[model samples]
Target: MFLTKIDTLGNVVFSRLLGSATNAEAFSLAVDSQDNVIIAGSTTDNLGDNTRISGTDSFVTKFSARGDRIFTYQLDTVAQDKPAAIAIDADDNIILTGFSDGAINAATPSNGGRDVMLLKIDGDSGQRIDEALIGSATTERGEAVAIAEDGNILLASIDNGRAVLRKVDVNDFSNILFEQDLGQINNSGAISGLRVSGSNIFLAGSTSNSGFTGTAASIAKDFAGDTDGFVLKLTDNGSSADADFVSFVGTEAFDKINDIAVGASSVFVVGSTRGALEAGGREGPTDAFITRIDMATGAIEQVQQFGLLLTNNEATGIAFTNTGPSVLDALGLPAGTVDRIETRSVDSQTTAKAGDYFDISIDGGRKRRITLNEGDTFSDIARRINRLSFRGDVSADGSNGKLVIRANGSASVDLIAGEGSSDLLGKLGLKSQRLLGTDALFNLNDDDDQNSSSTESDLGGVFAFKLDGPLGLQDRQTAAFTLTQIQEAINTSQRAFRSLSPSILDTLGDQLGGSASGVVPTRLQSQLANYSAALSRLQSGSGGGGFFI
Candidate 1:
């Protein structure tokens, strides 16, 4: 294990590495009144005079304020043992809560698989004072621990799949004062944060249950997605606990709380989400969020999400500093890097054909038909729209290969396609929409307009005017003039010819060519050759000739 002490300016004062021959890992740490750092973890190494019984063993190490080694205490066991949280009691006594598969001391025995373990040690002597193992017939994990105002120990644990809270008498290890199960029996949840203020106890975690209404008088919020982060406040009476409020916060995706901190007037929580949690949507597949809630009423005050859209980000820990609540997240971007979303067209179509016309009405004005001549590009479309004297500025963004229409000054930009318009709007990769004069810019591209109907109509018109036989069928004319479309048409035609009877083939050959054996007739061969040449031209970006369709 590595430990370091730093000055106020973040300069390292002293550093030390404490471990045995094998691997050692530290999970929880706490500081005493004298600034003595105490760490709790599990290790396979046999440090000091203690010997490892079997598997992994739990250990607590203390260091002085100046980074000198004070003492190390190890709890030997035959099964794996690990501490998840550490706390300092009123008299500077060390308390550790975690999970173990076997007995850590003589007083408590293993319940079954993995059981929650609570250990109390003398801060100065590094001696075990008491220990307790709490679990069911199945698995249980001790996740978080806090001290109440009345000098009692509050433990948050996962009993089976349910989150449970227990108030234990600090003097007597086996005396449990009160216990409560957090959610419904069928719902699976876990608690990662616990805080005590006055007579109220706050618990934060996540649950998969929907419509989680606490007590009838308690303030509650319904679940919003697959998994939602929750904050439950309980008024801890002398004998029992009553629910104050239970609030769920999340979007339409997975969200979970990692930690929480209570200030004088507000409760702050930090977590991660896959969807939007505030007015602005999420920035990436996953984003870290911090939410502030009213302490007296349990009303959400504000929520903010931060991260880049290109990568994942999450907040694992948070605490209240002198200024405000500080969060530790996993975004590793460089300094001064700002994250923003870019709007791009889903379909890249910059070219338009002749006879394509669409009626557009801007800012609720009179509808005007915009017609395209032969071989008009997106830039020409923008220029033509500008000449119509609209309240919006239209530009062709060549870098992103899309058209942008922004409202001029404070005037809103309304783009409406009239019922009598042609397929020109679809060809330009745009749709009828409105921008309400907001500062938020909107793109003039339609994500649903992938294959332009006008292009298909042109190809079909060409085929109907030039070809006869099966190639001249109206269905064949509807095919788009793209390589993939032409390839599919060719395959369908070949299949139809192969499935024809001998007599039908002979009739076709007599009208067009001669033989109808294994070889294709002259007329059919000529049509196939035309399609082959069209495919080559489309692949090379050269327009097809007379037989393009």
Candidate 2:
């Protein structure tokens, strides 16, 4: 990952690359009011840092105006997480939209495969303020994102081959102000661009007339050619009606729209065309055209075509400089309030024995196995589990010999024990109860109900919270243990097995071919030979051979 700075003259100022050993890419950028540039990208490794969780996680990094590194934070979910676009709100909070296999927070679990994901990050602390997972059962790709003047979020995407537009409330990411799908695209049709006007949104794309609505206008038009470019205008104020204007324009050839710009009373659509298009009088095999649509009447006002003769040409972007302050320059937000949650609770007892293990499941996350030792205390078990922390941290409740689970952000914290007959979980007083409390400051008081479990296997609970900003959670991508940690766990199991063995001979009996025919006279010599054979196999990594029988 790298952020490069250059002056208008194109002179290099500073350049820095992060995570030399991992594959990474910067997909989007935003700048705050303080001239601090924020870049969003993805990384395959833990960025060579142990503190960062592993997986194909995205990163939001900030750099000062002078080219100094401020901070880099990782954004992750249960599966591969990618940030496709980023925008800054009035409060300087960073809004990131992308796709993930699952939810990034407890409150916003993934509904299905490749769901659209939104995250709000604090500009100062590099922490998550809130989050949400929005999509259907199938795949949804969030292609573009923009912030409204009032701090609301406008997200545009193609879900299951159809265009999706949604507005998210600034205060609550999970709260959808509005959701609308323009129509499904045929094999060649696509949603190319999205832009937010004063209080309206302009969506420019292409659609086939064979099977989907080409324009939001009441009067549907037949496909003029293989595909037709379209421009749809809709109000963004949570209106449920159809788009105010939907104009489709194309001719008997391949036509595609790539971008849209909103003027005071007109909408400009830009894209490439293969054959003659009706918008422009000129008939060319390949050319780019800019069509202006009357904002009020959904009618094409003008079509301007430009291209080189005998050459293929297309216009992918257009810029009007000196019209006003650049949109990027006006992006910023004042510092917002900080919110956090800390809670402590106790287990009923501390009687977990050695060899007993139990599985844990977070808020619909994957199950993780946890084993206990005879010498393991509540504190020791808590510490061991804390090492695999996710959306929340686990610690020993010193006051009552219980577990202190704290959510670093305002999101809920849930801990569920998987089905098992582990006496350790029973002894620790695991419960099938949830933590009920507000995100606001509150302590575990007498008003709260006592959480307990009758069965040792049913440790489950949901921690609910209502907070001020987006909630960020560490993704449960894979098992938390590193290679070294797994090795340590294996070693610990071996030690425990050895310590519990009645006799060294008994422990090695299996490897010695079960006492060498059970003949007392030749047992010792035969056992030695059997042990030697097993050792050879172990050294060679052969089948059915290992240090532990």
Candidate 3:
């Protein structure tokens, strides 16, 4: 039961040797961008072909960027114990969690039983970096660990007769970032798995909740037809709700969660479901289920239930790759979920004019693009801008003198030179670029509507914008400006991005920290993190692999 990597062809690239006939169980795994695998789980048997630890001990292993075993170490306290899960950070640091026997020996402990414990090590040599035992003296169980981008670690445990969560610093491991209890009414249920994405933490396990004692808006669901697989999501702050607290239940009477994996924008759960289902053309029997949740809104995008009478009995472990939709589909996500990312750039060009004339068009009511031409007095543009901007949405100023334009109601935007800026058209081809970009992305969903039957759509709701200026000045032409101001504005408005960057980092860190079972997700997260870290470093002159890749 040790953590190991299997190639697409299914071969164990890593299988650590255990002591005396006792086997090693790899409870968790993470793979970094460098392709190195980090595994953690307690070892009841002595390991290493030669000398083994005298008693059951916790262990962490590291592999080279090439997947070769680099180092291994046994971690034990005065109390007897084992780690249940482990993770890695952007800097290749390791985090191992699970229960400790409440021991505190120098090298190895005398031994107690199971109290929540944490051990962080360098991915290069498996050396301890920081250690902490969460909870007050009483027994606690930790099944997962996640490190935020700023180097904060989030640990999930079963404490005080319920699931508890904690946030700790990665550097000195001293200050507690935050801590709170997860809604765990069950007596002593296990928090089997934990993975963070953005600011959200996804937890999966089975709970005995026959009585409906959850908070408001919490729906009580009976599993299959009767043992529900419970999945809970928490915020980085460890609160019950307030933008955190996402929960999902399986309807099949026999479904129970085995584990969970966190991705950039989604969470995956592998579990079992029994009773009537709508998979493989059948409506009855047991099936392995893989459910994908949109991490942003905790929305259940798709459900994939397999194995009616063949294939794997139940979904065991769910993993994701940067490859094809088939694999993503296997995880129960809608096929196109991973494909829209081909490019998410938006191009919007607003018409500009020194005169006091303004025009804003809402195609199908969802797509709005503004147009301002000659006669567009400062007041006209301002009025249109004001109308477009609701009180709650953020807006940017694109007007100076009588030349004006900007965005309303959207934090995410490509407010380059909205449709028509003379200076933008001169200094850079921003206007044309906007046109080309619009043509590329302005897809409409008119395909479903008889009126839009002549429209386009792999996924409808697309539109295109044609501004005034060159096409007609007083012909709607007059104003002009540089794209630099727009870029500056965007750069300024986007500073708030860092506001949400930490959660993204923590979730990414967890994915890259492969414990043992598999390195697939870790490798994916590492590649993304390194890509992000490299970009960040490059911007700060730190160094990087370059954009040539």
Best by TM-score: 1
Q: Show where candidate 3 strays beyond 4 Å.
A: 1-21, 48-53, 65-67, 106-113, 185-188, 210-226, 237-245, 263-265, 277-286, 308-312, 325-549
The residue-by-residue lDDT of candidate 1 on 461-536, one tens digit each, is 2221212312222433233223334554564444444444345656888876575467666998899999999888
Per-residue lDDT of candidate 3, residues 1-40 (tens digit): 4344454435444343322134456677777767777767
Candidate 1: C-alpha lDDT:
0.70
Q: lDDT for each of the candidates?
A: 0.70, 0.64, 0.54
Please report, as a residue range, the 10-residue window in candidate 2 with the lowest summed lDDT: 342-351
How do the residues 72-132 of candidate 2 rate in per-residue lDDT, one tens digit apiece? 6786554788988788888888888888887776867788888888888888888889888
Model 3 Cα displacement at 50 (Å)? 11
Question: What is the lDDT, from 0 to 100, of the residue 141 in candidate 1?
Answer: 86
Query: Higher TM-score: candidate 2 or 3?
Result: 3
Better of 1 and 3 by lDDT: 1
